[model samples]
Target: MDGWHDAADRFGVPRTDAVLLALNLYGLQTRLGARVRLQVSVPVGAQARTIVIAAGRPDSPFTLADSGQLFAGAELVGAAVRTDVDDAVSGYLRCWDGTAWRAATINPASRSKCTGCAPCPTSLEPTADPRLDTEDELHLLLDGLRQQLPHGGSLRDLHEITVSTACYESEDAALEAMMVLRKVLRSRRIDARIVLLSSVVRSREAFRWLAEHVGPFGLFLTADCVTRRNLILKKTKADLLPELMPALLADAREAGLDTSFTYIVGLDSTKDMEPFLSAMLPQVTLFPSLQVFQAHTPVMDGLHTPEADEFSYFLNARRIVESVMVDAANNLVPEPWRCYRSLWYESYAGQPLEGPRR
Candidate 1:
């Protein structure tokens, strides 16, 4: 109850009946035996307020104001939400498209380890159209992205593009969409680097296919936590992520693609930064393009506000990563564009560290 009001207050809107109904409907649909999060906030580049509903347990209370303090952790679950919070919050109670959970069961209360081989559903369903599939939606998305650019440049003038989905239907479907997008962009002489944000790249073949098909593309893999308990909290089957990520990166490298690992700090249950960093920094050095993101609890994810200490943990972790990089190598060129605190290596004085060439 307090969490609900906090969300409303953070959004600077009254807790009207309409908002309550939207939140309740979203909660019920994604409940699925675990607590569903109802995030009420205004998104960037939008006029009206928005409510994003996703499946997960809220371990803490979070508000719109806490966005800056949010750290990425293993408990993060991507959502497929129905747009609500317009005059009438329509499509509020839409069920999980079963896309995000195709790799694992939608359960956060489980105590056992996931098999890691949960079969992904075969049927490719489009929860969000145009951008998720269809050439028309892609164009619309491009138009929207272009509108945000300064001086109003077209898609061809853009240097980079990130194509993401709540959950990719499959590797094949993702490849197909990429191919279509590539063809369209090529026709216009638009050769922007395309980055993919999806969950279907666990297989070696998927990595190979991405390397072969997508031109100047990269995959964003978020390793929120290394512990099994945190992985369970995030409702992910990636328990072996720490072990498998190296192999995955090797596969991507072999295929001539860049794979960037994103680490989120400040999970409620996670306190120590050293263990996570100790295990992770080596990989960061290997990849050299690793990203570290701050975490916040989204109301829709049913997560709690990060503790004050959690944010501090994130700050300290960032400092430590930078320090480690400096010690490990001499030349640490800052890549603020990659991430605010990211370092792009030019050369290690003698070792010759190679950053992402593309």
Candidate 2:
């Protein structure tokens, strides 16, 4: 309840609704006795608030909830928060519209996207992504799609295809690959949309192309590192990302793109991560993802997982962002906590993520 109360305080979620959402999340622990963290998809005002579980491992369980594997009804109608506010903040949800930012309303995209084009995500791990360096490799990867589809699925079964900019030599190379991939999908008569994961640290042209042609997909900016000093993409610095992100996100937002930031937690000190997050939090729109670091991965670079208070970092982050940004902006901000858009916030009270409840 206290966790819910804290979330309600930050997100402006009603105590009643907070209690309900908390209970439902807690029910996961109560029933399965398996540890789970609480995560949300958007700010409270939207009519259809999503309770997306990052039930994904760093790249698995925490991502599983939204990765098209479970396909369950991830959207939870908040027991509260929807009202006139839903209209006011609807502009914010335009990013998740999965199509265009200015789109007045968005239908359940999966009905058309998920079913028509089950979305063949042609990918390789981003860290080792340079494998798709040339047209030959890109051609080979797309050609091999037939081998990658599910038991009976084919190219036509795809409504979405994920391409990570992190997996390319340059954003230009990635965009060129998209161009080649687009031609291939078109030739096959497969009308699949591309879901691009970009770091936004690269040249803006690739994303600019995506916004203009692909009709605005959620830009998941991957940073991987999280400390004040190392918070950066390959060559870009922390200072640059914050400045660069808003313009890109705002442009995408104006053009109708859902935007988010992704980082690895437990890779750096949460205390160092905190001030970094505080400085960076307000620069973001959608819930910035904090991927719980997994030790099993080959490259840890000497950091250990922070025993998973990872997600609750949001509540405090909300406070810091609001306090700081508010002082800077001189406004009465109504909603600062995007509790509904993040994970593990409730772990502080009772329902912990992957660990036994307190």
Candidate 3:
């Protein structure tokens, strides 16, 4: 019998309009390894309709046994059907309507949920002392570097300026911080890149603004995991990730900006052990920068404390990630190993100097 499946194969079906089919008894028993009973629905005017064709049950091949149309109107094509049966049925079949297949109505609520809304400011005022802004610290750091340079000096020559910030409660404050940094860098003629770490499901407007202004500079997204569950648990809005991330990265790349992903290891139970290793190991193609979780200076409360030996896990995970990069190089994946140095906590922050230089 002809059904949606046959039509789908004949004409490449879009996932948005695809309907699944299963034979009530024969197919269920064969596939699921159990005696099963089920019911299915079809359009009212479908051709080649077949009902239960049991030998002893009835003479007529097809019958309208149930009351009310299982589904109605042009919008019922991919709509799901619910049914129940007392015992296992013998078999089932589906028929296709002659004209174009029915189209299901899109739920407005579902569409809205999928489409992200504009980000609202969480608070009117800055949560921390405005005087304690990191921008000041950054300016001072740059000034210190300048003192060490020759008469005709530049910070661009020494260390590449890599700026990063945590996603606090307010997006307004974050933007403000970014703007301040941008102004300072431009004024000082410093060649620097900004990495905005946001836990929020960013609004399209925010992304557009970032692209238009900071698109030329580098941008990196920092997330706890690639999955939604872990993201939600970390107080991050999951709807924006994976999909949003790729879009942002694409835009940045097209704009000739450096794009990267930063992930902290040992963040969750799922992100530990084999699953974590497997998830991160193969992502070398993605060129992810890695950071290990430090037990001291906890970023979030109630995180699983890593054991002393777990340092080995971090090292091993790094090696695996590098190995995947090696494979990519061997396979000749274009732009394999971008050569961006991965930084560890101690190295980036620097080890405490035991004594002053003589």
Candidate 4:
């Protein structure tokens, strides 16, 4: 059979207008496993229909019949079959939200309760301005999250609440939002850690303020490249990070907060990150930590497509960081392993810190 063929007949759509997209077999080792989620996206005419088939390991020569219906109680739910031919299948999911079909998901395992609209942990992408949101906006959004949680889930039940401010008006505004959000979560008795994104720590003051208010929050710092030229290309300031990050790390250690760093590889160029890593890793070790690694992805707009060389850069960077940390740990120095987040918690917080929830 063809890798992709017309699905008009099987799905009851017009043959001339419908096409069967790839049947993505996920969680498969070599063949179908004991459990797998089959995500099929078929475009009929101008619209599309996606069916998520959940099932156990199927018989050889896999067929849809082996997969059971996607159930919402006794009623099976899915999108309508379109009649037009579209070449590409957009992976967005559709579900009946009581009244009409809307984009949804089957992941998070909690989304099984999706009744129509998008699920909780609702996205709050910041705008070009901070005042773009009213004071009550965030509280309302949190209320919505509480309402959307699967019947028995509570705010405390969540693992972590990640807030990314990649496009905020200013650092102060982002800081204010973080402070307010911390308060909102605290009032609800939700103990989930709040993971703030890059912009929240744009300056030493902002970083210090964040550490003071949101102590123990996670920092998701994404620096794709450390070179000056690439930093300019990415519209990131050169002096700010170099001067602020180390200082901020020191401050965080003193204040008993945790931070993590992510470096993206293969942006403007692929080369040795050793010099950069060597200079910074020691400073990073001076403070408590979560994670540090080089990640490369093709979906990033201006970055080069990650090829073999890019992969090499990523692997080499990881190897060097791990080796350095290992060497430090093996030495007979007094504070050999006190730089990790867990160490700080063990010494200061009076208890071992648990890993951040997913």
Indicate which candidate wins on TM-score. Answer: 1
TM-score of 1: 0.50
TM agreement with the true structure for every prediction: 0.50, 0.44, 0.41, 0.48
By summed lDDT, the worst window of 10 consecutive residues in model 4 runs over 340-349
Name the candidate that leads on lDDT.
2
Pairs in clash, predicted candidate 3: none
lDDT of each: 0.39, 0.40, 0.35, 0.36
lDDT of model 2, residue 328: 44
Backbone Cα, N, C clashes tallied per candidate: 20, 26, 0, 7
Between candidates 3 and 4, which one is better according to lDDT? 4
Q: Could you tell which candidate, 2 or 3, scores higher by lDDT?
A: 2
The digit string of per-residue lDDT tens for model 2 on 165-204 reads: 3434355655665566566556677676555555532445
Candidate 4's displacement at residue 78, Å, is 24
Give the C-alpha lDDT of model 3: 0.35
> What are the RMSDs of all candidates, in order?
13.7, 13.2, 27.5, 16.1
- lDDT score for candidate 2 against the true structure: 0.40
Off by over 4 Å in 2: 1-130, 133-139, 165-169, 200-206, 214-216, 226-233, 236-239, 268-289, 296-358
User: Model 4 over residues 180-262: C-alpha lDDT tens digits?
Assistant: 77787678886666655453365556666777787546665544345553333233323345435555555654555555454
lDDT of 4: 0.36
